[model samples]
Target: MPLTAQQLQAWSRQEAAAAQQVTTATQASIWLTLWAAFTGWYSRPQVSDLAARSVRILQPARQQTGGLGAAYVREVLAGLDAVREKAPAINLPAARLGADLEQVYSRPAEAYRLTYALTEDTAAATTAAQERLFTLVRDDLTVARRDGEMLQMRASGVTHYRRIVHPELSATGVCGLCLAAADRLYSVAELLPIHDRCKCTVAPDSDTADEAVSIDLDQLYEDAGGTDGAALKRVRYQVNEHGELGPVLGVEGQKFQRQGDAPKGDPIARARRELAALEPVLDSLESRAAAGEDVAGPLAYQRDRVAKLRAITA
Candidate 1:
C-alpha cells in the first residue's frame, strides 16, 4: 500500500493545521493570564497578582460541545493524539506505533516566559516593550507548537526529517544554518526547534515515502461519512469561543466559525500594561528584602517573576 505523495502531503497539512491550533491555544491562554494579572494589579497593586504566572501558561477552556474544562492546548494535544491513531492506522509504517515519543516538550515554558513578561503592574496605555512582546507572541508559539507536530509527523513516514524555513521569513543566523542544512537528512531528535520564535519546520524525507505502506483508513473514514479513499474527516479545523481551533460542523456539530479579518489586536495592549503596573510591588519587595526584613517569602516570589520578565531581553 504505497501512499502517493499527495497522501503524505495531505497528512502534513492536517498536522500543520493542528499544530497551529496548539500555537493559537497557547497565545490565547497567555493573553488571558496577562489580562487577569493586569486587572488584579490595577485593581489593587499586590504581590499576589503574580499567581497567573504558571511557569507554564495554563488556561483550561471548556469544550463548548460538552466535556471537561480542557484547556485549548490540551484539546489540540488530544485531538492530535486521536488523529495520530487514525492517520497511521491507514497502511502507515508499523514501526511508528512503537516509536519512542518520551521526549518532553518546552513550548509551554517559553510561552510562560513571553506571557509573564508581557504582563506587569501598570495603568499606562501602552509601552514599546508591551507592543514588541505581543507582536512576537504568535511566532513564538508557532515554533513551539510546530516542534511537537514535526515529531508526530515523523512517526508515520520516515525517522529522518528536514528543516524547512519559509523563504518569506527573514533568516537569522540560526534560521540560515537550518535552511542551509535543509537538504541533509537527520534524526528527529536532532531537529527539535532551536530557540524561541524559531520558525523552522521538520518535514519527512519523502524519498522514504516509497517505504510507507498505505494502511486502509477508509473504514474509519467511511464510518465518519467519508469516502473515495479519504484518510481524514473533512471540517477538522475550527475556531471556538476561546479563539482556539475547534472541530467544525461535521465532526463536532459546531457551526462554521467565521474567521476574523482583524489581526491579533490592541486589547492585548492593556494586558501588557498590567505587567508594567507590577513595578511598584516588585520595587517594594526588593527594597524590604534589601533592608533585611522578613520579607523573604514575598521578595523571593517577586524576584522569580521579575527574573522571568527580564529573560525576554526586549
Candidate 2:
C-alpha cells in the first residue's frame, strides 16, 4: 500500500527520534527504515549511503535485518537510483519493507547472547571479528593491578582475571569499566571494543606509572546514582546480593580482590568520607536539573560513582 504524505511525515519524525537514541551506525540504519516507512520519502541516495555505512559497522550477520538477504541492500540502492531518474513520487512500501526486514534480521533478539557467544566461544562469529581486529593493533599491552592477588594475567595475551567475581548476564559492568578507562585514556569517539570474555585491559605506560592511580572509589561510586539514590541502592543490592552481575564481570565466582588490607578507619567514618565527596557532585547535578540545564553530563558522572560505591560496599 502507498503511504499518504501525512503518514510519511509522521514516520520520519519517529525514525529521527529512534535514530537519535541509537548508539551505533548499525542501529541507526536498522531504525532508519522505520522512518522511511512513516515518511514515504525514501531518498535513494540517502538510503544507499546509510545502508553502506551501517553494513560497514555491524557484524555481517546483522546486515540481514528482515528476511531480506545482503543483496537486498544493493537492490534498495538500485531501486532508489531508478526512482530518482524516473519516478519522483513512487511507491515506497516495498522498499521500505525490504529495509525493515534487513533491520529485523540484523538485530539480535537477545543482544547479550550474541555478545557473549561472540566473546566466550572462540568459534563464534563475534570472537572471530574481535580477533581479526586484534591482529591489526601493535601496542604492547600489559596487565596493571594494585595487588598481585587482585588480578591475574592469562597465558593467552587476550585474557585477564579479577578476584571479585560477577556473572556475565549483561554488558553493563564490562562496558562501564572499559568506557571509564577509555574516557580517561582516549577520546570518546575512539572505538573501544568491550565484550564478555574480552581479555583486553588498559594500564598506564611505564613512564606514567608514578602518576597513574586507581580512580577514587568513593567519587566514582557516588557519581553513579546522581539524584536517584534509591535506584542506585537497588542496583547495588541486585549486583551484590541478588547475584545479578550482568555481562560486566564475565562469570560467577570471578572476584576482584582488594589489593591492600582493609582501611584502619571506622566503617562509619569511611561512609561519611564517601558521602562527603559525593554530596557536592550530587548537589551540582540537582541545581543543574532544577535550572533546566542538560542533566546528562552530570548524570553520567553520578552513575559512574554509584557503580564504584557498589563495588566498595559489596
Best by lDDT: 1
- Per-residue lDDT of candidate 1, residues 1-314 (tens digit): 44354444344334444544655565556556554334222222331233234213522211110111112222233333343221221121111122221111122223333343334323232233234334344433443344344434544444565444432232222233233333355565543433334444444554433222122221223332333222232323221331222111122354533457453445346445654765677787667667887655444555666565555433
Per-residue error for 294 in candidate 1, Å, reads 25
Q: What TM-score does prediction 2 earn?
A: 0.22
> What is the C-alpha lDDT profile of model 2 across 1-314, one tens digit per residue?
33232332233233223322322333344345432232111233443454344345443312122212112212222332332211121111232113343343222212212332223231353333333222211110100111111111111121222111111212332224332333334222222233333333222112221122223222323434333434332332011111111123222343433325465657656655665566565666667678988656334545565456656665
Model 1 alpha-carbon drift over 4 Å, by segment: 1-14, 36-147, 150-158, 168-178, 208-314
Instruction: Give the C-alpha lDDT of model 1.
Output: 0.37
TM-score of each: 0.36, 0.22
